[model samples]
Target: MGKSQKKRSMRRHNPMRVPDSHLPKGLAAASESSSKTEAILPIIQKMQGADAAERKWACVAVSNLIQNDPSTRRLLQGKNIVGTLITRLTDSEEEVVVEAAGALRNLCIDGGYDICAEMYNKSILVPLQTFVPKLSTTLSQYLDDQKTAPENAQKLVYEFANNVITLLWCLSETSNKALNAINQLQLVPFLISFLGARQKIPLATVTAAAQCLYVLSDDNPPAIADLRADGGYIACLLSILQEPPQDEADPRTGTLRVLAAGILRNVAPLPPPSVASALDLDAEIVLPQLTPLLSISLTEVSETALQLLGSAPETEKPKDSGLKNTPKSDHKSPAEVGLERLENRLRTVQLALEILTGACATLPDPQPDVLIDDEDDDEEGDENSDDNPDADMATPEEAVPDSREQTQSLPSLVTPLLQLIQPTTLSFPPLAAPSPHPPTTSALSAIHLAAFECLNNIFLTLARDRHANAADVGAVWDAIWTALGLVGTQTGLGQEQRRAVWEAATGVLWGVATVSRGIVEPKPEQVQALMALCDGATADAQLRVKCIGTLEALAQNPAFVDANATIAVYLLSMLPSANGPSPAGTEPMLQAASSLIDIYSDEDAPWDINFRSGGYLARLQGSVDGIKTAVRAIDRRKEGGKELRRRGEEVRDNLVAFIKYRKDLGL
Candidate 1:
């Protein structure tokens, strides 16, 4: 207790102050690569210079150069730029601090996961954390006395708070170490304070606060405990999430509401009796709370996407239609407005889908109840205490899913998630590319990625719901495949985005096949999509392996007979001509053969007419030697090759056995 008191007093005395003498005492390592240091060296020098203006602009220059430009971001990272920006977070000049924070935040997004982990590794957390206590003080001032600062100063403080919380959120999302540091710094209470006095601050700042808290609350026992202990905390989040009357015209309302719901989704308790069994949870008390929270998010996700579509700038084609566009006040161009609206809508839907996913998601098949002792009444001794440093913080490993079940209302969300799976078109007549190519960054692709991921989780739960008829299953399957086509065909997509979409989409198929089994049936077109993915050069080798494995899983279902037969016919038809332009890889054909064998392994399984009368087995028999050649032709050292080879050979044995079985019957 005494040590904690001393530490708090010391922090209070120097909440955000870092002396020049202590500035050099940091963990920024030496340049790992100096090749590009010469180019970015000037900005580094200016950042360290005594002139505050130069330092501020130096940060601004790095931020601007790295925005949406990966090559420039990489060059900057190699130049000790991240370390220099960390030092500037403690700059004496306020403008320099804000600009430096902005630069660091952009570095995280532009450089992605590696740079965020690098920033945490370089000890950026300590300096960045000092701002939270300081910002908390400013927030307290806003609650007590709004006139503590002039209006300009208050807005600046709001902007700084926004940048700091947002950067912290970004870091926490990417790095486990950063999350540990944030929890140790006792940041959640301060973050939640922003939520309490939200209306007294900027909505953007509140959104940032909500986002940061949402990230921290995910499966963190201490953070969840803190949120639950303070009833007002949950109240504030729920208040922000409560739907406003339709006439209210706050432009940022949708984002704020969804972010609050995300925090709720992260921190809420076990889903009620409706999700699975009510044995563990207090159903009467929990259901009312969980249901309304879900109702708000589900309503918001669909309504928000609709609002985004409606927000699109209607292209007034004066040339083709010979009608003058309506006069309007001049501001940003329609293209700019369309992009902004789409981006905001996607962000809202992305956050909301996370909540909807949690709402429908269940705990994985139970493991040993290691964390709880059913017979022991000694839980009181295990309670988190004030002296325990990590009482509230959960390690990344400990941050599991919490209180996510949409038992009652999950059926309502299928239409919206499926709708989101497809791309939303914006009729922007002026978004012409300079070089007849697509833009580097795309929000439409991102929206589908989020939707695809949410649907992946939603599928298992939906599959278990016997009330969801065949049409629902078919629609869900169709939407997932359609979204894959849209995202897979996206021009100018970066390799990373491509991998993410395929992973999410394939995850939906593979996860459902693994968990749902006979409850769900796959379509023939779905089979075609999987085969295309397995053989496409665009898909990395590992994902192609997964595609074949998923195809194998789907083959076991009785409803999968049609898809299996369709694939078998397609493979046999393409085999003799496979050496041509088509990419009928050996692995895909082998998996199809395996699926065909598995389907026929069941006695009640019906054979396709092509198999019965078309002498297909004999033709396939003729291709057996070629199949062996192709199997041997596959590079054994490629990713997932060992499993592929084993599965392929096993499939060969099955094919041979099935042919012998048919011949024995004199087919």
Candidate 2:
């Protein structure tokens, strides 16, 4: 081995141990503490203080404290802690309430409504929902005074709503409590009210409301009906469409957009077509608004518009001029305005269609063509050129050009969105530019979020429909992966946003693995491309976490296991030690070693040829070489193979037993 290789090889095998300073204090303490509840409640109480920022810190502390402590089960048994925390919902400081709300959310993350009810008993749920009206009133008055509120009242309300939504999601399985909470808040209306505000509300408010509706619709149809009964279903969704995103497009908007799409999709197929729709939702009203939205030049809005259109039924035929005819507008076309370039105009039309059609994977039937005989075309063209040529226009069949087949690999829908989101500067640069207007970081963020939302919808459609076009899938993936590369850029994104981006990208990556089965070879090149972007040299913590997550997912897939195994091994080997016994040379290794090992082990492992047979096993065995190398390294010095193996075997046995138990129970 060379010096670098030899050094790496010779390094002590350390199990992954993240640094204490790196970890949230509450989480670290909770992990190390002998008594789980004993270590956590005080931190949880601290979050109930009056100082919003202080409480925010306390919330973080509480979230961390619960990080690895499933043993706190008994402490949570009676909901005493939940009840205590909920009382802080009415704290004077919004941040304090936000933190307390967040803490309550964490408690119910796994325990569900049992925990939520305990919180509700403290009257937290009522305040949590009621706070929105108060904030709305406060915000309206403040806007009238033209004074920006010192506290982020909008953000506070959103956080409160988020906590409630999360809690309801957990409790949704119990007592129709989730449904009750949504109805009580009439959250859809509260969220829609913010759509017209001049002051920017955090994107979280809209997203939370949307997600709650989504869960409710999925869990209970009656809940969706009730939401509709409140007289704001379409209005709420449309209001979100109307709102201008912050400079950095918030992921919350993207989330809300997705939820809205899901809502439309869920409601679209089953609702009876009516002469007058239940909500007076004429395509006339929606379509005109959509036309302007399509031209706003933001990818997220475009994507969202496409999703809405996709969900909307095609109710009436066009009023002549076909799809290409531009609506009457002040800005004349290139020809009318004396600036028309045929190719450029075509591109604009394509983009407009892309936005309006909801990123349609399948093209409509080709338009009628006016056949032209080239040999005799000069005489006919000369005659036609004298007439109103633009009126008689060449159809897409004639105008798209011979190069379209070659250039159209990327869907027309996603390619433009990707272009908009692509960062001009790869690394941070000196503030040298003196342009009249500079792009704000918020705008850039908004673009990224918009791109992600579009891609998510496209992927979901592909998964659900199965008949979704492959070229469309490929094009969408190409654009999504390109944007995904920017997730770790030093200056472009915040830590929280970056994490969200990574998580969103993970969903796409996971979909690629899951959806591509039997159709294509798990393209190793694609995985490698993602791996490279995700594994930056500076090693941003969020990037590494997301990278590890994506890598773990890739390694689990049988088809990709062999192709991606080496990269997986490389990533796993970099797992930081969990203990602070640092002999670390480079940045202290993150404490992800155990997670890596656990990922590779298991009786259901892709390489477990005992159950799998034929060429599949052979392919899996090829991938086994890399996993085995890492296993050996763990065995040699880390002493972690035993724990991993034990955990893996335990999981495998449980799965098998569960299968047997399910069979017996006929469940």
Candidate 3:
């Protein structure tokens, strides 16, 4: 019977079942969520009961039950618990309401996008509208009376407000209706009130406020307008940026500042001087205020800041070094302490990377343009600025946002980014037996993705601008090559993250290779690895093109001529025969044309180059009829790209040059 059935999803996360002293022992040990009805059913009954205390207990129980356990989420959700929880939002018991909100929020986390969508469809925003605002009044009372307020009362208000704000963020993230409700209900100003309080409000509540604003304001016009119209909201976010990223354990870690920057970043093309000064924001002052955050975020992590991730955690010792070693905090075990340190480091670094990325608006473009304005027009060493589109590194067209130059330490960031994205062997570095918990594969991949994106912008910029100092170009390219070839080795890596890495890595190698041929010495294995990708028909189209582009980029340097020539012959085989119909997609055809042109098109290239001089160019000449047939076929297709057509013409012209050069040599 379906009643006796258990969900596969729940079974997987049964290992994360919440520990509760009051739970039935049999239910706690039950292997399946369905079999644990003895435990879960009572909580549902209690939540639907008259006693407020039991209902509160049940609300917290559901929250604890589903922390990371999705099976239980599906089971409870199937039981219609969300609707029951919704009713509690209007329950007379404030404690029940708070716990209920906490439960709904947990469901949002455990159930992911689907559950959040479910909650929204159930009309959660209706009760939440009237219920959520009351939390602010309680918080306001606590804010006014410091000594007179009971400590428990203050904690309750903080918990209630924090949970509700977080719940709203989860809700708004799910659907357009909820997002519209957010602006209509004027939640931005309410959240701004807490964030602006700064030191006065609990950091958790402030973080909740910051997080909600960060989510709602991103790419949402109404929310962005709400944030923009409220100058105090902007100030609240800015004030956080003004402070240094604080000690992790110390409540003031600059997470708020990071979120603040994100919110401001969304409000881009930031109003003109009037927006900055006279019209909108005091941007003249806002501009300098932004520098401190960037300066702090961009600086390489200090030895002390990153030491925990390197070495195992040890307890604090007394000055005399005679007393038994005291535990660092609350007698925590080395493993526990090590895990904490690792988590803190990952959290800090990822947040910093986000800020650095945001400062440049690094998304969607290979060459990131700064969205926020910089006071000075200091181009530094960027010889190929916006003026010369044909310059090795031409300026990106102005984005919708106000454009500025790269950050001061942007180029120098290569070393730090390189350190974050190492080969698999170095991923878990040796650190005694109990290693200071190495980064999880997912975390490492995420860091690699962000780091590579940063590198891509840098390399592409440097390549285009003809800036020679591509800090550690060899190491950067190696990391990128490793990512490109990671599918077989690291199965845990996400495709999207891997694709991002490839995009960044290719952009990086393309730029570095463009600036100078030999900066990244070409290895035979690297060439073979790239060729291997092009060999398989089942390989990704983008991967194939990127692989071909990488070979072409490296071919510019003489050190890679032999390797490039080998791939050139391989690509020549794929060209359509003069008698055959051309392939529908021009990518492979265009890629072949582009690579052939880069090689044979340079007539003056030295004899050491294997193109015509080494029989490879003769091979191209033999296949010229077939290649032209393909180009003609491309021209015949309605959807054939202009660039593809142009590349075909160039290939045809280059082949003509090859024939003349051959005739002149009397070969």
Per-residue error for 634 in candidate 3, Å, reads 11
lDDT of each: 0.57, 0.43, 0.57
What are the TM-scores, per candidate, against the unseen true structure? 0.63, 0.35, 0.69
lDDT of 1 by residue, 1-82 (tens): 0000111112111111001111122223212222333446667777788888878878877875654444456667767788
lDDT of 1 at 70: 49
For 148-172, candidate 3 gives per-residue lDDT tens digits of 6888878777877787787788777
| Poorly placed runs, candidate 2 (over 4 Å) | 1-60, 63-83, 90-95, 106-177, 180-186, 195-200, 227-236, 242-249, 269-667
TM-score of 2: 0.35
Which 10-residue span in candidate 3 carries the lowest summed lDDT? 1-10
Best-first order by TM-score: 3, 1, 2
Model 2 gets an lDDT of 0.43
Candidate that beats the other on TM-score, 1 or 2, i.e. the better one: 1
- Model 3: residues >4 Å from true position, as ranges? 1-42, 68-84, 146-149, 175-183, 243-248, 269-345, 361-409, 423-442, 479-488, 492-507, 533-540, 573-585, 607-609, 613-667
Point out the worst 10-residue segment of candidate 2 by lDDT: 1-10
Q: For residue 230, what is the lDDT in candidate 2?
A: 44
